[model samples]
Target: MTASALTFDEVRQARVALVGPPNSGKTTLFNTLTGGRQKTANYPGVTVERKSGRLRTPVGRSIELLDLPGSYSLRARSPDEAITRDVVLGRQEWEALPDAMVCVTDATNLGQHLRLFLELRQLGRPLILVLNMMDLAQKRGYQISIEALSRSLGIPVVTTVAMHKNGVQDLLDQIDTLLNQASVTGDGTVTTDAWVEPTPEAIRGYHQEAERLLREAVIEEGVPEQLTRKLDQVLLHPVAGPLILLGILFLMFQAVFSWAEAPMDWIDGGIASLQQWLAAHMQDGLLKSLLVDGIIAGVGGVVIFLPQILILFLFILLLEDFGYMARAAFLMDRLMSAVGLNGRAFIPLLSSFACAIPGIMAARTIAHPLDRLVTILIAPLMTCSARLPVYVLLISAFIPATTVWGGIGLQGLVMFGLYATGIIGALVVAGVLRLTVLRGGRQPLLMELPSYKWPNPANVLLGLLERARIFMRRIGTVILSVLVILWFLSTFPAPPQGATEPDIYYSFAGMIGRGLEPLLAPVGFNWQIAIALVPGLAAREVAVAALGTVYSLSGSEDAVTESLAATLAHDWTLATALALLAWYVFAPQCLATLAAVRRETNSWRWPAFMFIYLMILAYIAAFITYRVALALGGG
Candidate 1:
């Protein structure tokens, strides 16, 4: 059993890095390389940082997978690009240099993305160029001669439709081969190619080579060109594009409220019925109360939000599939360009509407740290789905469900306003932050605008399923755990026999809230609002769930959804609800996101700082809203 006697060559620890331009399918490739053998970090040094994973080859050799930030070049203008450059070049001694590198380039846009490829070629590392998006390119009549590309680049070239995993086997095979090779793949030419600059001569040479290659191997039907041009006319229209994007975003929030109503109602009804049944069949005791109010109510409250979250994602996925998202990005790039942000940042910021955790994670695509940090700082302002429950609760309870603009629901209008506030606030804040902390001119808006295609059902379904899984996991894990703790807080210190406020009022939570009220007085919040922030740290949505549990523990036996909303309406004033909403717009509530920061930074300092700073901001914002509303003599 000796290593050499086994006849099989022992596997060496191979460090592999995945790098590509934004939207070039680098993530799909990384996921394919190492699926479950990965850990995600919340907050770290740069808002955008590498995610690492592990894989063992069939030969029992180990491989470390580094998912690097997607960047257009190695010029190192931003933290993300600097990281990628440092690790790839072994400039960062703390991080292991990649043994083999995969440069993922969009097959359809190779002419443009090739600039990075050309730059990477001189790095003198074992590298392979992955021609991703091949299927889409093929459909558009692109034909790449692999051998020709390999010869041209002097490195192995593997073509793949990464999303579909097409050609993955070949890519892996080449990677394994490259890993076992003696010299680095592109290292041999480094000494001779002393030029770091892509000089005018170099640019002319590349252009000439590219023209020759296109003439020799590439084929495109005139159809795709004409089709893309026609689509771009409407999609890229100055006035029309932004309007369409806004309408779509507005309709999405509306759908989150309106379309999910039936399912949400069904979930609420089922939870209440179960609770009553449990109370009837079970012996009266702590167990019954715990099941009904603590676990069931807390967990169920978060669960009902799944439909709305998924619906929000569905619209995003469809728009992206229809190829309009890129155009929207282009349109917004006009705005982002003014502030020195990346156009590639649009999708990540959009994702923030679902959750800032993923939104911050998604910023991995931005090449600049400042751009990513600004994006991360402002992402939480996008009115994530977590706040949807709170918004829906308050709006239903307070605002009359009358239509504005003829067809929109009155509740929908309020939700839209919250979203608008987030968006408008983000823009103004981004401008301010860019001026002060991250002052820089807009980065170049160089991004591939993939051509329009029919929405692929399989991909869409897979994406939806993934979102559903993550949604359920959070409810089952983080939300569920927080619910138990909140239930305990609201239930304990069983009321003194003579006390009359409510069981919860005499409970430990009630006392804590009362003690904290003075600090929150200007914010128009009562004891209940103060106490809920405990579990809210687990997630933003849990605040509503905590409210449901705390409110239910007071002996109210109504449905979790409407009952909570109505109770708040009856108990709190308009100013209180408004202040709370404003607080959520910038609340420092997600511990998971903080934890992510800790993991990414490998230190507790950043997450701790984040919590302290955000909490302060939230309090000030909440207080301002409350005092102003009170001063206006309105509740």
Candidate 2:
């Protein structure tokens, strides 16, 4: 086929940036417009994530919507805020000058939110002021003059309830109008000079402007709303708040174990049925072994815990949407600051519940370098989702399937204990580091407490689906590869004619595990457990699959298709099980997490130190756990 000259159509898509203070519904608005089409990646040469989505106007005009970090001002503090400032000022060489700026502001906090708008107005960009949470504002009997605000700023004003996608269409229409104006004016090129370096005088003037505009446009009937105020009395009470926070987290873990029982049973039954059918129908061969022993046993062992993982994320995402998560951080701020970190470290540490890499990247929000480093160092101890499979596997295998009063399962209690262990460990380590190395003065906690609202079901569903996709993708790729390699290591070098034990006892993995047994014996690890730990360095979740594979090969031929949990319970002592759990709680992080530390810190020194300290802690903790369990007759 002959190539014709490519017809070039001038793309008039506006480079629109959605900027606002944290928890200002900026991301909700972006998600509302983009739906499922948004992509997440890192900014060039920086670890901070860049999120963008394609938004199409009613008339079919497309615009690139950029979701900038939630920053309070153009005057940069944290790395996230710095990126937002540079991008808005057209100073980031990697980004185009925004053709339009969607300044999302909380309608209830206009006095403060409008400060950003006043600053952005100085840049001379086409600005659309988004007054979000209008429904809540109206419910509280506050009146806002959209027309007056628009006239004062000389820009279109769009009001939205981002959670429910209300007023999103209006925002899109305004964006369309701005893009048309920009194309007509031929001012698509960025104007860096328009943004002068902001000084204290300029910031004060902007705040004054914001206050004046709020006076003119906003009528507050019940200032300092009573609902949040009343709730805060109980939720923020120094003693009550921490107790309630702990109770909530404890209940979450309990729910993860109890509510997920039915689904986990279904998954487990399905796997067992499939394994039995394959074992009976297929002739014994490498193919059958790989399918039953490698794929099903390995991947299925990890996949069985999917329901529990979903439950964990469900609680987190819901709390986040309800705006209670910020409160949890606020409640923990005193404890965090005592360890030489500030309240800003709480969010990143909280993010670690999902993954440490993002949690480490999130440390960019901490202004102090030492505080940020301390947060990154301890982020791995926050019981990330990767550790969920291991926790679920051990708890299921060892803990009894019984419930305490109030219907809390014993298995869930153990799961909660594991998570709590990690949290307490992180705090303890952070405290020690602060005293010895990263000592610094306390930084003031400057944070916005968003008004509480019901979490949108659609958003919750989408968040859960996204988390499931990420987990499943890892299982299919990383877990599958690791399982295959492990299967090979356990299957090679056929047993001698008169072998007395399972063939795996003579395989490469078995020999290596035996070699490490002496070193790990004090912690109650066996040859099989030692072998699993090797591949676990790639991903913590892989340890569960590795155990499944190792035990599958170690079992007698007649029991090849037995459940991994059943096999574990039958072969492992209670002390060993608990020690293994303790080991995982403090184990050196996976290679990916270590690599992230290296990249974030710009050196091998931190990652090396992290591995050493974590390993030492893991060993000591495991040794202690093993000894105590033995004394308690768990052995």
Candidate number achieving the greatest lDDT relative to the actual structure: 2
Q: On residues 328-371, what C-alpha lDDT tens digit does candidate 2 reach at each position?
A: 87887877887777787877786677677667876897877788
Please provide, for model 1 over 430-507, each residue's C-alpha lDDT reduced to its tens digit, 9 standing for 90 to 100.
787789867875666556677676666654665677678767776777667766777788788898878756677777
lDDT of 2 at 94: 81
Clashing pairs in 2: none
Candidate 2 global lDDT? 0.81
Best by TM-score: 2
RMSD of each: 5.4, 4.9
- For each candidate in turn, the TM-score is 0.77, 0.84
